[model samples]
Target: MNTDPRPSEHASPCDAAADWFVRLHSGTVSKADLRLFEQWRQADPEHDRQYRNVCRISGAAQHLSAQALRAILKQDAHPATPQQHRRLSRRAFGLGLVGACSSVLVMGVLHRQGLFDEPLETYHLQTRRGEHQELALPDGSILRANTDTLAIARLYEGRRTVELRRGEVFFSVARSTRSPFIIDAGSTEITVTGTRFNVSRTDSAVQVAVESGSVEVSGGRWWNRRTRRLAAGQAVTAYHDAAPEGIRTVDVTNIAAWQRGDIIFDDTPLALALEELNRYLPHPVHLDDTALRSHRISGIVRSGKPEAMLEMLPDFAPVSVHRQADGQIRILPR
Candidate 1:
């Protein structure tokens, strides 16, 4: 017998519930199967929760308009149901219906729209890995998509909405009282009233740097912690598992210069600055010297040249930057 406290067989029901949900979302299940699924869902609380997760993901897919869906599908070949609906092949379709229906594209859609209901029209723009793009929104706001960023946005009725699920983005708002905009980045909520700023959220924390105007940041509390508001020329960072910390006044112009193809750092630790600089290069930059990790860097780096960044690092620290044949950058102590 297994000694672990967790019920080993508990996951099977959840997995099965997820499968039933995908079929329901794809509109493939017959009426009889739908009744059977409802029976299964009502049987247990875990089944209901698992089914909701699947629906939330699937609902996001349905929110994408016909034009956008076709465009996205065109970029990649999606498995479509045949007109006659033959039996699934036993070889390639090894996971059966689960793998085929629970695709990233469909799940991503659900994740975006399932946050709220009532069909709030929002405008959105995004870019792929190794790519950066900019666009002007319907509300006259300007959006800059950092590499590997995806955004969903809309300005409808009386509210403006923008959702950034990953990567970094800079927003320059046009200012509208009738529709105060809100941005959902991970667990942080940024409310804007005609301001310019940049927000970056990673797996660990969320960083908000203000260029112009003030913004409200809420819900980064840890136990009895308090929320912080960031003003122009200020930056604040909030991380998971810890209370939000660090409120500093910095030059807004230098911080915002990355939008103009310049990377600037001011007494920033090499380890932290390396994380920001690596975003601009095709190949990732890594530090090999443990001793050089804590060195502080303050300078301007041109965005396009990885080799130039490597060369400039030798001036501030006792380290040499080397480029491997495979294109990854490695930093070594000199």
Candidate 2:
């Protein structure tokens, strides 16, 4: 949560919920524990959603064989904390309780981060600045690449992997019992079974948001990595070589609204807003007064009409926007 990448720092409400879920169902429940769990659930509305997701996935995986579960623990390559290590051993080996789960709880049916044994065919998906494209993969998944994005897709018999080279991608993945969809974004790895999510990669960071279903965001040191499960309407951001920050609540409907040709900002900083607008603008936008960077901006601009973002600048912030003869836009304090 503080960008430390340590499990202790980055564990989200979802992570805590998973631990509580396992403790309660492990035949080791106590009255005090239940009371504390209830307090946690009530403290934040997101906790309930996170806990329900864990239960639903665990219920679906109740029929998996013990051997299948073992394979998951071994191949996951995630370094669990001492406490989590114990829980994972009990969950994977005991098979009575599964902790920190997604839909791919069955190891025989799961592939960690799309690492496959079969020879795979590869292809690329990309979009130039201001361009948007939607593609349907052979595996029945629909992928949308936003402006200035590059993603590589590799298809094998049972699993699929996509590396986000740059920019943003929104996925509507098809469900598979024996196959999982994986996305490698810089230093982070995301695993999914069936879900809709948006991943945006920038020069310095990657952000993941779930619109429906859920995703596991994994990163941090290889010897001590951390993973957080984000349910629908939740989002996480991480810098390169770091674990994801604390998960944040979001409006899932606005996740990747650019796919609909709309760019929505909710009280964003002026400098940051202009940075995003530059992605679609033919000419870069610059702020003349550094002090103006603190100004807040909130509005909707049509992606197809990038210039309109500049037009609306004056209506919100205490700044004036002007277009140069060369087409570049500059903002100055009023």
Candidate 3:
């Protein structure tokens, strides 16, 4: 559905992947653009392999100079499993599991026969509004939980699982020959050996993006079950009932921009861009005129910074920003 020009049939995979990488990183991503990207990647296995190669080289080369990048990747490229007696809840257990917050604690489940196969290590990872948390897994993996995220990580002898109850999580999984890292997010599930990727879950859909290595994403509504493999630099969004569409090439760099406390928008509809910005703001933003929803805007604004984001409205559209005594932000047609 994307109108962008694509590579020729004879074009090399690197050329095609490089083109996709540029488009995705241009700062605006659309369902149609991603859909078309999926088609290209799914058309051939070589496409995916080459795309991953481009992402690895680009990410390491560009991001390696940053201190934050060094921390996330120094142990990333260096980058788990388990089996137990087979008796476990295999689910997050607690009344607060559905609450706004939960504590990180280990269950005192007793092991039989003093068998040292391995004990399950479970962690309740969460962050409040405008908050971010970074954690290190026992297997040397790193988890970056984004704003208002709630996920549970469980480690067994041959399997490692993270149940994403809500929010987004970026994983740098440690390589393991025997164990596979699994992520359960709503109806979606992702499996990998060792990879760096991002998983974002909402009530309706789940999104998966691979930064390095590859991942298998599977999930659907109760009526359908879909599975799709995503190579590094590729992403896919699965809805509740839709089938596995395909893999879309994405910007492996900006996918984790929240780590830098910023959000980028490029010619995105006002309504859609507001929806993403509201995720970081404690107070919701409102538009005084519903008709202005279709107005498109583009800019870089710090995450959760209402003033900086709203001030640019008039520059892009005939809208003026307003603030209410009740701490509400709104936009009025100029």
Q: What lDDT does each candidate get? A: 0.65, 0.72, 0.67
Error of 3 at 256 (Å): 1.1
TM accuracy, model 2: 0.58
Candidate 3 off by > 4 Å: 1-119, 244-246, 266-272, 286-298, 304-307, 313-325, 328-334
Clashes of each: 8, 0, 10
**Top candidate, metric TM-score:** 1
Whose lDDT is higher: candidate 2's or candidate 3's?
2
Among residues 3 or more apart in sequence or in different chains, the pairs in candidate 2 whose N, CA or C atoms overlap within 3 Å are: none
**lDDT per residue, candidate 2, 19-127, as tens digits?**
5554454333457767877887787788788787567545323223334443443353453345544444455545444443432232224333222234477878989
- The residue pairs in collision within model 1 are 57-110, 60-109, 60-110, 122-153, 122-154, 123-153, 123-154, 124-153
Candidate 1 displacement at residue 47 in angstroms: 13
> Judged by lDDT against the true structure, how good is candidate 2?
0.72
On TM-score, who's better, 2 or 3? 2
- lDDT tens digits by residue: candidate 3, 1-334: 3344465577678667755654454434467878888999999998887777555423212211133322221232221112332222232223212211111101111122111224378888999878899889999889999887999888988778788988888999999979888887755778899999988775556778888999998765422455799998888877655655577787788777778877776565677667666667777778757898778888888876746787777888888877789987887888
Which pairs in model 3 have colliding backbones? 79-175, 81-157, 81-158, 82-156, 82-157, 82-158, 82-159, 83-157, 83-158, 221-240
